[model samples]
Target: MPFPFFGDDKSTIARLLSTLPQTGRVEWIGLRPARREQLLTVEEATAETDRHLTGDHARPKPGGKRQITLIQHEHLAAVAGFLGLAMPLAPGRLRRNVAISGLNLLALKNRQIQIGAEVVLEITGECHPCSRMEEELGPGGYNAMRGHGGLTARIVQGGMFRVGDEVRVLEKSSA
Candidate 1:
């Protein structure tokens, strides 16, 4: 069957056809108590519905869209290279809570994903880069993280997840 296209825009067509859900593994986890605080790598974390991680300080009230933040492992190197860095940037330095591999976090926006065995998160929006990137990533860091800042999620179901946990995209019916 012939596929529909948006005139000569192949990128548009590709975006329209790439809605299938994806799966990835949880590569790392980070937590911090408050803004401007140092991030700590953790072996596991408890995700609470409508709240930030158990020990995190940014826990907004219920219904807050920024309950959790996630970044793709693939984008780290690209962001580093964009800043003309010689080494791969650390996930903690990016300030995102979870670093996942094997799936495009950008495409997961508006979709529901299950992490580890129980935690469920709804991709609410993009985690835009803040001024902190400038100080944390050094000069030009903010610009380097602009489009590669990863995604923000809202926890739908509370549970525990750890490093190496499998992140699965939930079906529409399950979400």
Candidate 2:
């Protein structure tokens, strides 16, 4: 037998993407993404990470902004992604902003996800890895993630995010 609400047991989230360097310890928090404005197309949302010189997982603070190494299923738009590999690839262990074990990243393209209460995100495009992978993940990490490098999208609406929240991928398109 199998459970229903649990969805796909093979599917996992927030597995771990390297703990924020000490003082910056931010927990798994939440997995989400959004569009800049209600009108921005999924294409625009995918490029939102370009604003981040550092990489995906960037955040806006009081004066400036900081880049976040990891972005979950929805929020990936803001920072982009490196790759989504099936752990134990080789060399050392690497991490991802969001843990997508069961669902195929491509399957969600141009789709909207309902994460908990009202956090909705539009799957824009794929998140490819950069040189950073060599330093963070193991030597093989970069090659392992290749094309299936997670996803990215902009924030359509603003709200709070927390870990352990239930995420529901909707079929209708937000565009």
Candidate 3:
């Protein structure tokens, strides 16, 4: 049977998709200073409007869709479970720029979110697991991160964001 929310009305679906009230928190931040290097953990970072985060090696073109990457903090345990680990995986091991808790990152696709009081990011798409996952996570690492990889984003507004900052989706009018 189909979900009751999947009715013929398109507007209802749109409304449902837009109605995310939960606020997320930034649990961790990592910066890749260069390719093939381990990510460095930071308490805060600066995001550049329409560009990549400062101190991060990623040099995205203007208006690039992949200015930053984010993963669900809650998924760490899920990936660990897949790998038969006794503890949650460290956020840096995944190589994502940020690990967020509370809100569902997938639901933020195509939407803009404000991190803390300043920086704003537009959720672009999924951040697929690369072959490096196999090397970093071992054996089935790539497969383990298949559906739990994370989301890619483009910086919309720039500013300093710190760990423990609140992440909230901006309404269409505000975005």
Candidate 4:
């Protein structure tokens, strides 16, 4: 059985809370063309509206809710602690594409945020930790990343984004 709270709970507060836009900066970028492939660290990458990164394996399904993934640099330590890891966790192992330093990814859910003044992305939802977490992060890895798994987003407007790019929330008219 699934957890009760995982299902839709239509409440005003829930709707209102997630609508707020926030800002952050791009700290790192990574790409993997296929599953189990080595992560390629890049200074910049192009985001396409029809597909993910230029070489990512999965395509946005019919709904196109997940064109990219982003993780907060701030949560690395928290996830590491949960797994009892002494060293800092690597973002590549998490299989996310972009790592941001400031804004809370969760807060941007369903909102549009611009990256480096070129690309715009809409936060789709949480990127749940996959079973691979256990294999890569060790025994308790899967569980440790439960709520800290990062976020999935779809590219709204495609453009080139590089490391050290400033990320900002887009106003309704601008988005």
Candidate 5:
């Protein structure tokens, strides 16, 4: 079969992917900046944001507003290659809570991904590189993913997402 994970093939990622029995729900749905210990759906997260005043840094933090994100696994390897890191077998290098393969994350930027068992995530926008990336790599790491196409989205519904769980694009691509 044809493999679709991006970046340099890390043994860890390959091992993780191999552990998956089948490729049914090969995509991983996720949430970010969640300070609540666990991830929340978009509606709930948004409601919480509305309840708090702007710049309220009390509990949930201001940045944890509802959002969604998606990226093709293959693209992640491309990032390592671009960075010249020789990313081999490390699963978490992508920094994505859920690593999804077999889906066109780059093409589906700013779209919604629905999980049958739990919730729906509204694809907000691209998840850009930050200084943290530089910290992860050496110096020019951030420059590697300049335009690789990772998305940032809000969760519309709250639910549990696990590894190997199936994901369906419940909504059409917005852009």
Candidate 6:
């Protein structure tokens, strides 16, 4: 479901894609203090409008599409299964900034999601797994995270969001 093709005309597939009524919850938040450095797990963080998270080292230019990274909590076990692990990998190990549960992040692509009450992020693209996954998760890690890598976003409206905050997709008119 590419976004550009879904306009006001309202096709059946477009309606289904836009009908994400289930709300998600923020399960974890991590900040990359520096590039390639271990992520610092936190209970809460502030998103700066048109910028990255307050403490995250990534300083993307204004309106940059990759300001934040998010992964699905459900995918943790899937990735672990692919690696033949008994336990799910920790959120920090994947290097994503936030871990969300209860909603399909893919469905939010090219849309805007409101985190908590104030933070709004535009789903820019998929957050593809990097080569570092091999070093971080041991051999075959990169391949294990291929499709489950998650999504990338740009901060649209900045505000504080905690680990337990609700995340919901905003309607096109609202976004």
Please tell me which predicted candidate would have the highest TM-score against the true structure: 3
Higher-TM-score candidate of 2 and 6: 6
Q: Mind giving the per-residue lDDT tens digits that candidate 6 earns over 43-77?
A: 99999999999999999999899999999999999
Q: lDDT for each of the candidates?
A: 0.88, 0.39, 0.96, 0.84, 0.51, 0.94
- Angstrom error of the Cα, residue 99, model 5: value is 1.7
**What TM-score does candidate 4 get on C-alpha atoms?**
0.84
Candidate 6 has an lDDT of: 0.94
lDDT of 2 by residue, 1-175 (tens): 5543344444332212111121111124321233221211111112122232122344544222222222333323222233354333321122334333324446556555544465555666766766656655556546645663566654444344444455555655336
lDDT string for model 5 (1-175, tens) is: 4465555667656554333232335343334443433322121222122122122222433344323334566677787787775763233444544456766555444445665466566655667777766766668777876775466555566655555666666645447
Please rank every candidate by TM-score, starting with the best.
Answer: 3, 6, 1, 4, 5, 2
Model 1 per-residue lDDT tens digits across residues 143-174: 99998999999999999999999898886663
- Residue ranges of candidate 4 with Cα displaced over 4 Å: 1-22, 173-175
lDDT sort, best first: 3, 6, 1, 4, 5, 2
- In model 5, the Cα lDDT at residue 34 comes to 38
Task: Give me the overall lDDT of model 4.
Answer: 0.84
Tell me how far the alpha carbon of residue 127 in candidate 4 is from the true structure, in angstroms, after superposition.
0.6
Q: Who is ahead in lDDT, 1 or 6? A: 6
User: Per-residue lDDT tens digits of candidate 3, residues 18-57?
Assistant: 8799999999999999998999999999999999989999
**Candidate 2 Cα deviation (angstroms), residue 173:** 5.7
Go through the candidates in order and give the clash count of each: 0, 16, 0, 0, 25, 0
Please give the RMSD of candidate 1 to the true structure: 3.2
TM-score of each: 0.89, 0.47, 0.95, 0.84, 0.57, 0.92
Candidate 3: lDDT of 89?
A: 100
Off by over 4 Å in 6: 1-10
What are the RMSDs of all candidates, in order?
A: 3.2, 14.1, 2.4, 6.7, 11.6, 4.4
